[model samples]
Target: MHIKRVFDVVVVSLAAVVWLPAVAGGALLVLLTSGRPVFYRSNRLVGSGDPTKVVKFRTMVKNADRLVNRDTVPVTNTRFLNIAPDSPLYTRAGRLLERCGLTEIPQLVHVLSGKMTIVGNRPLPTNVMNALLDEYSYAGDRFLTAAGLTGPAQLVGRDALTDSERLRIEGAYCHAVLDGYRLRLDFSILLRTVLIVAHLKPSLSYTEVMDLIARNSGSRSVVALDEHASPRAADNTEVA
Candidate 1:
């Protein structure tokens, strides 16, 4: 894990240099296009017990949370079909950010702060985390490592995946980490992630990747965190 942390620090530092301008531009765009409070901060669980704030460019309207409740869809589900394109809760600027994937750039700060890593399990919303824990036995195992900006699941199909398929991939990743994490694996995942961002599809099917993870996972066992741990509330500040 020490090696992974060192890698994260070095990579994130370099990324900040390259992405700092983009981050600033994104922030300014959000302010002009959407209005004030250009950043949206949410509470996400990192490890089993660590709750950290994840920042993103504010893509939705200030009243979006109240206008639309994400809980309508069960947290364990991978698809968020309820949030349609025509939904009033979604802002024009937010849709563009989502399409270009610029909204997530702010999370580099979390990566630098050690609240997240360059590659690992994607962080879940507090409610989603709790729901998954209640539904799946393997949910806690994913938390054994820090949340990731990009990972196998993201490289696979992301929200296009079914709940079971998502959990399977996540379990495979957790198992791999517990058994043995290597710099090579991280580099491979990072490369694939870049391809994904560049609009290139992965050559391997999601099932193929899952099978690969299973074969490489070895026999390591991962323990889940306490189910009763309380989640922190995210502070939402609206700037006019």
Candidate 2:
């Protein structure tokens, strides 16, 4: 457990050489194409806890968050404030930064400060968290550990996943953390995140990622039953 912190520091520090310059370049792009405010701090939830101040590159136009809600985006994304990658809300610079994952560059600071992590469940925007808590009784438990920059959910992405499946994968990761965290497990997720972002490897399917988590979870209780084992026609059930 303690070692994970050390690992986070080491991984983030080594990446800083490039991350600093990349963030700078990204910020310049935002300034040139959009305007002021290179970064913004959001009150994202980290588990079933109070909102933590998380820093992110400003990828949207001014007053963008105020304009969107769970059901208000011009597109059909039902999660994360219902904003899709192609939402018209994003500035020209915003689209590029988001596509490359550079929008989260400032979060590396929180990882170093122990406020966030390198691997765990991804933090939820307040709108998504509130909706989940209202609809799913066990939604809060999806946060067993602190929020991370990338984790099981990010490994598979939001498009290919049903919201229920995404929640289950997050719950499974929390279950593992509640059981015990393995350094090797977190490392693998982090490595896969970089590879996928770099387009070096294709994103894993939910089943494939679940298998990876189950294998390194170091517990018999970490089983994620295959959702595809039997198809139910609209009578679907979510994992707890």
Candidate 3:
């Protein structure tokens, strides 16, 4: 919608104006403490299309991605779910950045550039997206909207929820947008996002989340994927 786009640009531009100084300070801190490469660039697919480089403040040791074995680790609330607290992969400065979410400040550039919105589904890396598609039938529906810096899923549970629960929340969000996009709804989510960033508990409850998932699960537009299927075989399964 025109209003949504206008809202995104206006709100995000104003936010950039307010947060740019913090971004600058954060960058300088990363450089002085960690040395060079103040930002980390990642290829993320906001939708089902080609990947785009998403920038964020570097919050790990140099080449940390290359060193971590993601498949063997446990998921956590932090951005780097696989990197444990004691892991040598985290730089001293990076830990502080992660705690305060300073690492994500650079994504303001994404919001200003129209590559992302202030509120929407979180963008997924290519491999992670593909893996989700393999596991859940409704997973692809998340790509229906531009990815957000924060969203319903993030406010609802984030890394604390299981994979199935996450996909369900995302599917409900996609269904909500498809039904009718609303400025008020976006504003509500944005407010909740601010609270979450402030380290406050969200008002959303487990019952509410499950209710949304149950309501949308049987919708003709959203299909459920087999949780157990391998990537190769998942493509062949019929949508239910």
Candidate 4:
């Protein structure tokens, strides 16, 4: 923990050094194939006190967000689930990038710029962020630290679970950070993440995905949120 920043700089710098070519290649592919910007930036909550525009390879269409607003659904739902393999929004190259996780490669820029870390909670989409704060005041607090490209919850499941469950896992990860367990989990998280990527297969459904994550992360309470409860009181405050 004492060498946290040191570790971040050294590891990420080394990663950038080794992966520079891949990063450049990914960017060039996006530019050439999509004929648009090589990167995509969207506002997300880094933590309770930090808001940032997360940078990643532009995998979707140029105005994909405007066209589909696909970020609102839980990954298990129809918008993403029911999409045909030949959906026009995804280029042939883009589908490969998603499977290989290359689309996320540009986030290294954000990590290098100090807006994110090599490991921490993945940032939330804007609508998801608003929904989160509207339901759980303590949820946005998870973003108080630098956003992570991958973290405890991600090691558990990348695109699984409901919004409320994601919040619970995030909260648990934040608790681990506060309780000084980050160092203990850091290497394990990295190792598991590598394994997951290496074995990338079909998309896991939301429930199955979340269950795996909850189990792996050792979360004791990842219950569903109250249906009728309104968390808007938590929203008036600026998240950053």
Best of the candidates, TM-score: 2
Least accurate 10 contiguous residues by lDDT in model 4 = 222-231
Worst 10 residues of 1 by lDDT: 231-240
Supply candidate 2's per-residue lDDT for 128.
Answer: 75
lDDT value for model 4: 0.61
Q: Which predicted model would earn the best lDDT?
A: 2
Per-residue accuracy of model 1 over 77-138 as CA lDDT, tens digit each: 33323365566766788887776767788888888888888888877767767665555566
Better of 1 and 4 by lDDT: 1
Q: Where does candidate 1 clash, by residue pair?
A: none
Candidate 2 whole-model C-alpha lDDT, 0 to 1: 0.77
Candidate RMSDs in order: 8.3, 3.3, 6.0, 6.7
User: Where in model 2 is the C-alpha error above 4 Å?
Assistant: 71-82, 224-240
On TM-score, who's better, 3 or 4? 3
What C-alpha lDDT do the candidate models reach, one value each?
A: 0.68, 0.77, 0.68, 0.61
Q: Compute each candidate's TM-score over C-alphas.
A: 0.80, 0.88, 0.79, 0.73
lDDT by residue (168-235, candidate 2, tens digit) is 77877877766867888898998999999999999998788888888887745557333433223211
Can you write out model 4's per-residue Cα lDDT over 1-240, one digit (the tens) per residue?
A: 345555667777877765688788887887777777778888777766545678888777787777665353453321112334467888766887876767677787777777777777887666666655654566675675667888756654634544445555566555555544435455556666767777854334434433544444433443232223322333243232
* Inter-residue clash pairs, candidate 4: 46-143, 47-143, 47-144, 48-143, 48-144, 134-231
Q: Which pairs clash (backbone N, Cα, C closer than 3 Å) in model 2?
A: none
Candidate 2, residue 126: Cα displacement in angstroms equals 2.8
